[model samples]
Target: MEAKENTTPTPTTTTTNQPELFTASDVARFCQVDLKTIHNWADKGEIRHFRTPGRHLRFRRLDVLDFLRKYGYPIPEVLRLGKPKVVAVDDDPVVLASLRKALSKRFELTTFQDPFDALVAVGSIQPDAMIFDVRMPGLDGVKCLERLRSIDTTSHIRCIVYSDAEEMKKNATEAGAYDFIKKGEAAELRDSLERLMGLERE
Candidate 1:
């Protein structure tokens, strides 16, 4: 009866976690480009990168995904971090449409035509960033920004005030906005967002 005892063993499974930061050679391999090209990109500020204490270059996973998406490169499965969640609140439907067209590909965008509604949903949305219009009918962007800053739950969300009135920049900054981008400056907005993602530029 003792010889009839079974000797089955349980199989163990292992999982590998992807890195949050990558080396130049790692990025090169991911992009299918030579190491020199990666260096060039870093030098030219075409990709988001930082230098280690030893002067070695390092890139964040999100930044690599941004580079791949911006340049039409195929994103490797290992490097596919989800897009940054963004909430754009603007009273103007047209402006919201333009934002959708411009940033939809790079960000997981949610738009609100009413500032109060945006505020109500912000806690639940937990967006990485918010795009606010300086002037709106119900709650102006600056006030919205102030409200969010006062709330502990939404205070840490990066807020960007998108407006054509250059005069509002000061107020926006005072209201705790991370940056103010003049409307129609798509490139500047993209650059600001890249910086928000912790990209270091020389």
Candidate 2:
């Protein structure tokens, strides 16, 4: 009998490639500005940028596009869709889902069910604003807000705290929360967020 060869299928993996990143020179050229100006924008957080492990600045293509839109610069055809970034943290799946449904249209929304992950993101992404749940498993919202305010990099971010417990509102406000929304008040929260971001709800 001939020896049979064993044939096994190997699993194939896929990777989601990130969008092309824009260097400072690329951004300066696209914005019709000097390279020094691009550096200044990144330094002051006027534009979003990522720091490489080697400490070099890298700009996101979409973020640069958004900056152009905000400054009335003509957006390129590939970069026309620009919206403000907002970070929302909640332990409840329903609340997160509601937030996505409500705010995704007007803003580039990032949601985190884990408060710890949200805290880390705030420091790195430096979102325009944040919405947090007052009660969560670890690092409750009030404490989280306080920590953020204490950090110079994240201190200026507007923070809103929401909870089912009415008494926590005072705690949230004192902790540097920009506004407090009672839990389950999705419409009110949406309106408040719009007002905070200077966006008119449609």
Candidate 3:
């Protein structure tokens, strides 16, 4: 009897073989950095990416948008809206989502999880200000502030870090935080936000 022939055909990826939204070369060009720089950013947790089961790195287009919006890095000699961008970085997804939903109408708020990655976005987005949580996974609020000031791109971006701990607030402010808010009351937050945006404070 003849051996049964194998009938199952292996599946092939047809839809643009690239599962990644961007490659190192692509990121180098977009962020105006070298491929090595992109790699470095990845290593430092400056950029958020996902690892495939095959060990390939995949970047999110949303993350890229947030990055560009962070540095106020304008589109080169292209269509520009000239509106300001704002970034909110936190470890808690719930808080991040809530902030985005609440402030999406008024400000161009981009939310992120990792503080270091948020700084990377700040370089690209050039947002007018930033709101970050004191406690995060990678970089803490104070460290994030130091890094922001160190970078020319985000040197002027307003840094705001809030915490329930008064000690954290004091430490954050001393570390060059623009404003600190307690975890509760949204009233103070609203007022501070309005003033920062040059809106009439209520």
Candidate 4:
């Protein structure tokens, strides 16, 4: 499997109001990958900030952190290097853990009992696809999908909706979800995922 994005987000103090004040060394450590990787980050526009009159490139502290998370750089509650490479979001802890257990051996899966955290992590994990419950505490599946689409990096990834509420199926499909598997339809769910993963292969 691919290692944790191979990043190096070095830490540093930023100029109070300046969003761009990172040094080469700061980025090196913030990303936790390597200095060369930092340069590659800048080159890729994954992270960028300012330039001095002498043309010295600088990075923002927040940007560095965002990039670190986006790349799944071994942060809290995240297991980057593993199988399945799947991310599943549901507010119910029992359900979340159960799904993780069922799928962990089959895929590199990560579970988030909170949809909000999953929303934030999506940008980082860049999971090939996602499965989220419809009725979350703060964000419903459709709303969460909206948020996901708003971010350029995670927009194109396939998402599946799993909700007991049949009402969400239309909304999820309209929102461009790959499919909305009514809760308990494990076979249908598996089929949807197989179809999606097949598309990835193509």
Candidate 5:
């Protein structure tokens, strides 16, 4: 009896590359919802998400943009281009110069020494974030923050209060500032910007 030789077949496998991920804020901005809503959607499995080791949730960037388009939410051209527009307000020329140098690489910075001008610019710029000098001569940072909050277009823009006075931190927070940093504290400012822009912290 001749025994038949057995032939083994190789199994075929397909690998899928995942799309780029976006932070909670990115999804919220695209969907025109709060960050909490993004979290809720992820929690309820209403939206596809990726969970990090620390339990942070990330959304598929393409999926989120598509979702926005489906719901008729406008996507900014800059966002599509992967650069965030930022508005910075400082009454000091030196500070403005420093900020321009510090943040130009990561963001499109539109700076104003006058708080009033900054307020006006917000409507046109539609920036992803803002940094305001807490001690501006006329309209202070807290007031600027409040004014921005009252405007429909600028209300959702994340704001950081730049101040040397430790006492003003609470006021800035109360006035809807997203974060606060001491003037000239580059590292703190960087951290805050990263957090606001959804960049991973160093």
Candidate 6:
């Protein structure tokens, strides 16, 4: 049996503020599949896409990212648009929703309701920063931060503690939290994260 030929393109340096579009051929090249497979994906509504005025199939960058993430594909750097990735661990659904509303536009945000799950995923996510709710059911935020600090792969990730309890600040700091923010302070959290990630406000 012959090994499948790998045709993944080299990462490009193109950066754009506007939404980027990829043709079916580009998607095929990125996925290392036949061009017809991409068209079939579009036709089957497996991949979110639109048609140009000339009826040429086009896939938005975000849509492509979603598809790649869903299917466990290695995300190409060009599709990342240099956005700082962030992972947030919170038990409250409302808090997660609020965090998503506040931070999704500025960063590549991924949230987990379970701190344990976040801990497991963080190694693979390799986010630039993480937000942890101080009070969770199974694994509290401080322990989570401490665990990450103990691990070589995750120790370098900047972590911020989010909670209403101010008393946890010292403990969180000692546990290696990069910063601490009170819950409901979305603006402050965003600013702190931007600074931590070295991203200028747009």
The prediction achieving the highest TM-score against the true structure is: 5
* Clash number for each model: 0, 0, 11, 17, 0, 0
Runs of candidate 3 exceeding 4 Å displacement: 1-83
Per residue, candidate 4 scores C-alpha lDDT tens digits across 148-168 of: 766666665678888898887
Q: Candidate 1, 10: how far from true, in Å?
A: 45
The better-scoring model by TM-score among 1 and 4 is: 1
Give all candidates' CA lDDT scores: 0.72, 0.70, 0.60, 0.60, 0.67, 0.74
Q: In model 6, which range of ten residues has the least summed lDDT?
A: 1-10
TM-score for all models, in order of appearance: 0.58, 0.59, 0.55, 0.55, 0.61, 0.60
Number of the candidate with higher TM-score, 5 or 6: 5
Write the residue-wise lDDT of candidate 2 on 1-202 in tens digits. 1111112211112121323466888788778999899999999989988877897778765466568868978655443334556778777877788877877776667777777766765666556678877888866667777888887677667788877877888888999998888877878887886666545458
Q: Residue 107 CA error for candidate 2 (Å)?
A: 1.3
C-alpha root-mean-square deviation, each candidate = 15.3, 11.0, 15.7, 12.5, 19.7, 16.7
| Best candidate (score: lDDT) | 6
Clashes of 4: 17
| lDDT, model 4 | 0.60
Q: How do the residues 84-125 of candidate 6 rate in per-residue lDDT, one tens digit apiece?
A: 667877778788888888887777677777777677677776
lDDT of 5 by residue, 63-150 (tens): 4554565667776543344445567777787887777777766556677766776666566656667888778687766777898788
What global local distance difference test value does model 6 have? 0.74
Lowest lDDT block of 10, candidate 1: 1-10
lDDT by residue (1-202, candidate 1, tens digit) is: 0001111221112122545578999989988889999999899999977788899998766567778878888767665444566778777777777777777666667777767777777777666688877887766667777888888667657899888878989988998988999988866886787666543333
> What does candidate 3's lDDT look like per residue over 1-202, in tens digits?
1111111221112222212255666667777888888788888877766666797666654354455556665433211222235677777776666665556555556666666666655556566678877777666668777877677555657777756766787778877787898765445665666555544433
lDDT of 2 at 136: 84
